[model samples]
Target: MKPKASPKTDQSTVRQRIVDMAARLFHQQGYNQTGINQLIEEAGVAKASLYQHFKTKDDVLQAYLAQVSQDWFRQVERAIAPLDTPKEKVLALFDLLKSFLESVDFRGCNFQNALVELPPAELNTRQLIRGHKTKMSQVITDLLADADPDLAAQISLLFEGALITSQLYHSVEPVNAARRIVERLL
Candidate 1:
């Protein structure tokens, strides 16, 4: 005999399914290009179920952005966890970016991509993107607390640049080059 799943658990699972499918679709295709009907179809959930979880398409997008922000930070923290020094951790960030870019086939930053697709009126979505970036900058600042204050800012810029360049060229060479520059800065 199998155990029965609780109502809450079932609902949560369905919600997660929608969000996961939304992330994949939104990332693979532009945000504006992905329709609610497509998300419902791909997620294998009924239209009612999708609406039950997310009131609007923007709500689903907000949820996706929130999830990605948490996931991205966790990945960054894990990647830098083993390093002993601030500089080492900072350099490791670039290495992590290289691996991440390769793993995603140079898809580039999700927030950056979303920003381009979003209209200027999307204040909430824009705020979420800005918050993610601000948190990332804070992480760099924390890592370089004892170094020249400007280094963190500079590294952050390089990191973003590397991501864009890597995506543009469909290669990780830009990430490697960024790592070298970071090494020199450190």
Candidate 2:
């Protein structure tokens, strides 16, 4: 006889689907605005199932943050892997951001946006944001190990400022502006 299928047969992928939906909704709609009911309805999971996967909305936020950190860094690393110079890697960062600025999903840095939703005393959320920024800084550090410290700092500042300006103006001009700054630094 074949094994019986349960109503919860979708359990295997339910959590991942929930996390993915939450990430998308949180990024596109803003964390403060997305609600638990919507997360379940969109994920196609029952309320019990959502609760089973995540104790609270905050849990899902953490999962989304983790996913963003991992996905963003992995992409940046892969995008620069074929390049041969620190300058190339540094410039490539803007190229990557340019694509993001053009994408329909553009909403600035997720970590930075979350700061508006989460209180400063929210340790886990704050740490995740800090950790993401630190990793980004390390990427620049590794890429510019032999470059001038001032130049590295300037590039980092431009990269960050570009994200905000691009989001605010809904234009790639900020990225272009940052690229120009980077050229002068180099």
Candidate 3:
């Protein structure tokens, strides 16, 4: 017979499930358009359970972004893991980005979509988006140091442009365009 699990493990599992569901819904639909009922239904959790985990939908949205940020960072690290040089690592970033675009459920960058929907009054949501940008920019800055320090800033901007443009246009060409530009510049 198995030992009884701790309450903490159960709570964390539920919290993670909620985040997963919200991330998917928030990506497929805009943040404002996704209702709590949908999240609860998709997550297969009771309304009270969700409320116990988060006081409001805004809180869940923030958690979803935070989860995405962490998962993205891990993916970045994994993408660059096999590459030995910083330049290879820089190129690897584009490859990793391409993989995301090709994913079956790819919508857009959730953080970008959320930022567009989050108004001035949604300070917490805005801060979460800004934080993700800063972190991703820092990753670019580190990877591009071997190519050119200043180029990191440009590359970071280009990365964002690619993400937003590809998302809006529903074309992988924008990402390819950015990658070509990066290759030519570096």
TM-score of each: 0.97, 0.91, 0.92
**Stretches of candidate 1 above 4 Å error?**
none
Clashing pairs in 3: none
| Candidate order by decreasing TM-score | 1, 3, 2
**Residue 163 shift from truth in candidate 1, angstroms:** 0.8
Worst 10 residues of 2 by lDDT: 4-13
Write the number of the candidate with greater TM-score, choosing between 2 and 3. Answer: 3
Q: Please, what are the lDDT tens digits per residue for candidate 1 over residues 1-186? A: 999999999999999999999999998897999999999999999999999999999899989999999999999999999899998898988888898888888888888989999888989999999999999889999999998889999999998899999999999898888889889888
How well does candidate 2 match the true structure, expressed as C-alpha RMSD? 2.5
Note the Cα lDDT for every prediction shown.
0.92, 0.87, 0.86
Give the lDDT of residue 101 in candidate 2: 66
How well does candidate 2 match the true structure in TM-score terms? 0.91
Which scores higher on lDDT, 1 or 3? 1
